[model samples]
Target: MLKIQEIRELIKLIDKSSINEFKYENDGAKIVLKKNGSGESQLAESHAQPAAVQSVPALQPQASVPVVQQQDAMPAAEQKEKVQDETLHKIVSPMVGTFYSASAPDQPAYVKAGDKVSKDSIVCIIEAMKLFNEIESEVNGEIVEVLAENGQLVEYGQPLFLVKSE
Candidate 1:
């Protein structure tokens, strides 16, 4: 995630640029920086809030999943194993920002499902205040699931990826 100092720099750059709005996205994070006619800069976060609202109704229909209901009384060990089998680790957002999977529009994505990563590997980018910051993996693992989608706004501490740690 872009630091506060980096955001300040980006705001300064926006003040000097002719652009009234700047938007950046990677993975599922999104940052939208806007300059009003009076030249006042404002930062807005983008997320799946609208989609979340829509998904609630869709999930209601799944209440009849008898299999899941039966699993509610699972043994402690089995429950732990089931959870472990699902995800070994999560890559979370350090700050509120837009997530980007690649450096640029034409660039290939840094990683995808089944991709392996080391502790220092660059997994994605988070843009805050018009500045892009490369986010590194903190664990050695293979990506199991990408939780966020490109251009989605992610909140601080939001899970961005699920990794099966090595």
Candidate 2:
């Protein structure tokens, strides 16, 4: 179990560092934190007006969900719809490796939900054996969902994204 003080300390570190994303794992548990561009900017701006630090960390218990506004959080709900739909297309991993969404620290993510993809489109970067491999989409369609989080380990034939049939 995670101690309250430890969780609070981690939150402080996240806010202080310019690197908004971090991950750490041990034998028993794993912790990950990321900053949403809109969310962070909004919080920062709100505080700049009041001259007070927005110190409350957004953490909802029992749910491993990223904090976002209700409207911006539609991806999770839409993701469920995509899963339930009878889509016959999926972007599968070609090799067993760790999946990365961005090419480098300064690069934008390869793809996100609602992006149109083609058979030649590079949808993600899969790191295998210390090499970063660009994983391409095998189908031509709109990307409806991304199944894996950035930096998550993936296996061969794993369904990384669900694409609606063209």
- In order, candidate lDDTs are 0.72, 0.67
- Model 1 is weakest, by summed lDDT over 10 consecutive residues, at 54-63
Identify the runs in model 2 with alpha carbons over 4 angstroms from their true place. Answer: 1-85
Error of 1 at 119 (Å): 0.8
lDDT of 2 by residue, 36-57 (tens): 6642311111222344322322
lDDT, candidate 1, 1-166, per-residue tens: 4545565578679879998978867556566677764666666544556453211110112222232345778999999977885657988887667888888889988889999999989999988768787889999999988888887777656788888898
Q: Which regions of candidate 1 deviate over 4 angstroms?
A: 1-82, 85-87
RMSD of each: 14.6, 14.1
Query: Model 2 — TM-score against the truth?
Result: 0.49
For candidate 2, what is the lDDT?
0.67
